[model samples]
Target: MTPPAGYTKAKPGEVFRLKRSLYGLKQASRQWNKELYALLHSLKFKQSTQDYSLYTRTQDGEFLVVLVYVDDILVTGTSTSQIAAVKLALDEAFTIKDLGDLTYFLGIEVHRNDKGIFLSQRKYIKDILVDAGMEECFVAPAPLSTGLKLSPEVGDLLDSTPDVYRRLVGRLLYLGITRPDLSYSVQHLSQFMHSPRVPHLKAALHVLKYLKGTLDTGLWYSATSDLKVTAYSDADWSSCQFTNRSLSSYAVFIGSNLVSWKTKKQQSVSKSSAEAKYRSMSATTSELVWIQGLLADLQIPVSLPITLYCDNTSAEHLPENPMFHEKTKHLKRDMHYILEQVAAGFIQTAHVSTANQLADILTKSLNSSHHHVLFAKLGLISKVQLEGGI
Candidate 1:
């Protein structure tokens, strides 16, 4: 609230009095966040520790949840009467406008039916295509070219501004929120944000071509989905040619519906493939602990000893092996954290064949047939495509 120059009228020795300016104040956004939190808290909503923007209330067999994202508010409850009452109360307090059930939020589109809910960013992808001048480009079968290896100094620099490359990659990162299929490709492209090369831009365009034909494809949340959690962890050892770092990725499921996924290069190089796979398993176990905590907040009971599948047999037995210190002396100490969870009966490890591993799609590119099979299993069903027999 510092006053602008030339508005003060006083001697240097005396206090200079000036009008306080509220324009562009630092507390604007912070004050707004506090105001929203206080208003929701006054309505008996308990804020979530895992995610501060979420608030929940349960009383007399009625359950309600409110999620605030800046100025936008999403309110829902199990009881229709209770939801209506809350909407009315919020509208009266804030003089707000109610946008019915969430058909669209941010840039993603939502459609629901008897089977489940589907989320897609078809419009967003189309907009990106137009911006990149690829509206009539050729279609492809997958996001990245098969066996394509990208490196920091592999190709010539783009004649276009580096800012342009950074912006496109940034948008693709957000697009991966619902498109788990794009997780690996986007993460791979993100590595060269500082100095993008021709190979990287070409790889990004390949992803756009794949999206061209599959615009209707989206994540499906089955209405019958339960709280049962299952996860698959996988890795590609030394995939990064530049740094010799392995790629680690895992996918989490709520019953049969895929809910969470991630793909990242391992922080350190592993001496053996088993060690790399073990690191991936540790990451998956850590995510499960957090997921279970969130489920607890929702009053849903999670059935454990939760099953974790890994394609590598050694990594599968690493947690239960009593002599891990002798066999894996070279591996990082953090890799043994899962052993404690296994001993506590909170986790169970199982062996899964490479062909059946869902996390495979998140770690590396696959053939057209293989990609389609995993895509269908991940619940990326397209209602429009199914109806039209595409």
Candidate 2:
């Protein structure tokens, strides 16, 4: 604490102290983070390199993991005693109230049974529906219309304020955390946040209607899931009519449990479907590598040569084939990176038929039946359906 230039008071070593909580200050979060980091380090927990928010400590062959999100912290692992100790330490230090079990945290609901754990944002979705005045909306068969192609300039700019559309898209983006089925649709609607049109607004509302019908749908983690890492990568080549950008998507799994997935438009335009698909594979490989590191930090062993499934035969062969085609000269960097991983036995590429491509749901809009089929394969389940409810 530096003294004011004009002040000639007191001792040189005297420093000003903060009398109030740092709740509203910008530096509050940073200071809190630093303090928490120091405390966790003192507890012998190693912060994960893959994710700084994650910390892990091992004692007597048991693992204790801590996940931090601002003030909300989640403690879990193989050792219950260590978790309790850590909680007590945190409470004594910061006066935190322990929320028993992990049923709810940060707006996500967790359900556990003998089978496994189920994660959902059902109440969050309901809140969104009510905010959009769609609580009584007619339920659609799917989140997106079959074969629908959204164009930025197709319809008149929404007569209502564009904030409505922007807010809806933002909420839906957060909802996608547990709802992989909404990934592609939310990604599509997000593109027009700058200047959303009437058609775009309608499509966003359609998603709300679908949400009303499948309110209980969410990812299911099976207790018996293997530790094997498998990933499915796909691309909708040149899918955007206006930008001509291809959509790349991947679904990553730890055995049969879906852990991570993404649907994003490619930043650069690809000349061929193979190139687009290859780019998608590159993205998926990066995610797979990160997941492997994170699992290792958690003391979980993942087998090598993680299977990466792609629908394009050419893309699948690009990493293994020695000869590079003239047309693929532009993708040399991507090819080299993928090949490096393949050579080191970090990942193995396999050709999967489009019909069996689970990531197809993330790359493009599919017919109702096809969408549901792929959705089922993505490890999404509905609690209502399990209990024989419509």
Candidate 3:
């Protein structure tokens, strides 16, 4: 075929090649990123080393941030004109669509108010519940059953289809974006993805039943809160039935708003409760450092010594003391990275009572009272209003 005007020709008997950019071609993303980087450099925007997707430019003592995810861009600055100028510059170079005031993007529902921006996946949750045939099912009070120790011998499997089990788990994983309460239970059932027994599938459906009752639950960001970073860490010793491995969990907050959290089974067995708590604390500290870098790129300066609260006083004391007991020596070298940060004045460890530890919900199943307390602490609420604007 003959090549069109202003088009580049390929080898003999080949058609004209499509223009290389971020969205269309195989190597388009790399090429478009290179172009965007060059443009930002020309505009005096400095790229962050910690996260390359973040870019910043300062003028007249005011800061402007531009976060790029491929071709999608988010700009926030001290002034609207500054953001407008950057958008105009980008539009001149490439065909751009301005998504004014991000409401929905990348499966996350963004709600902004005078208080702050809140991000959730409520619509996604509703869709998953409807798809799983649980839209009309009775709503359970919790994501997991009380005293339910799901093991290899729970019951005879009813769902013989392995693909159905995988599909259910895949959808549940997406729900984890807003439902951190489901993290441990989801992680527990996900292990049996390959050749999932009938019991495993039943346990997963129980989680779906719980979601049916709490589909509207989500995290809320408060605009009135300060940007102080604090974290809580906890562990459930020997929680896994198959391996007897302990479960470690952590939840981080910027003031009263929860920002990040995790619930995962530890790979190695801990000798004591103190060892388990220490391991969980170490994992939480690593996440804290990464978040600090992210805030720095956004020009949000954090004061020295981020605070981390742990319920285990023994583990807290061990970090400051050089006397490593025989039992504590088994921890890997990488786990000590957090200790180094603490010594360098990057993080400060504190003590919290076990009852007040928000990460407890992530580590183990709790009773209704404790569950409600932790859920409220995590910024979740049940706001039921009458139809007549009651």
lDDT of 2 by residue, 1-390 (tens): 788788788478899778744789988888989999999999999999999999999888888899999999999989888888999999899999987989999889998887788889999999999999999989999988888988878899976789999999999999999999999999999999999999999999999999998999888888888889999999999999988999999999998999999999999999999999999999999999999999999888989999999989889888998577689888988998999999999999988999999999998878899999998888889987544522
lDDT of 3 by residue, 65-170 (tens): 9988887888889988888999999999876899898888767777666656666677887788777787888877787777667766555654657788899999
Candidate 1 residue-wise lDDT, 1-390, digit = tens: 434577575455565443543436786678777777887778888998877888899977999888888778888888889888888878887688888999988888988777677898988988988998889999999998777778888799986777878888998999998899999889989999999998888888888899887878888888887868999999999888878889999999989989889999999998788889999899999999998888777777989999999999988877877574655876647556888899988889999999999999998888888988998888897768545542
State the displacement of the C-alpha of residue 65, model 1, in Å, after optimal TM-score superposition: 1.0
How far is each candidate from the true structure, as Cα RMSD in Å? 3.1, 3.7, 3.7
> On a 0 to 100 scale, what is the lDDT of residue 139 in model 1?
91
Worst 10 residues of 3 by lDDT: 381-390
Question: Which ranges in model 3 have alpha carbons more than 4 Å from their true place?
Answer: 1-26, 152-160, 332-336, 382-390
Best prediction by TM-score = 2
**Which of candidates 1 and 2 reaches a greater lDDT?**
2
Candidate 2: residue pairs that collide:
none
- Cα displacement (angstroms), candidate 1, residue 353, comes to 0.5
What is candidate 2's local distance difference test score?
Answer: 0.91
Error of 3 at 44 (Å): 2.7
TM for every model, in the order presented, reads 0.92, 0.93, 0.87
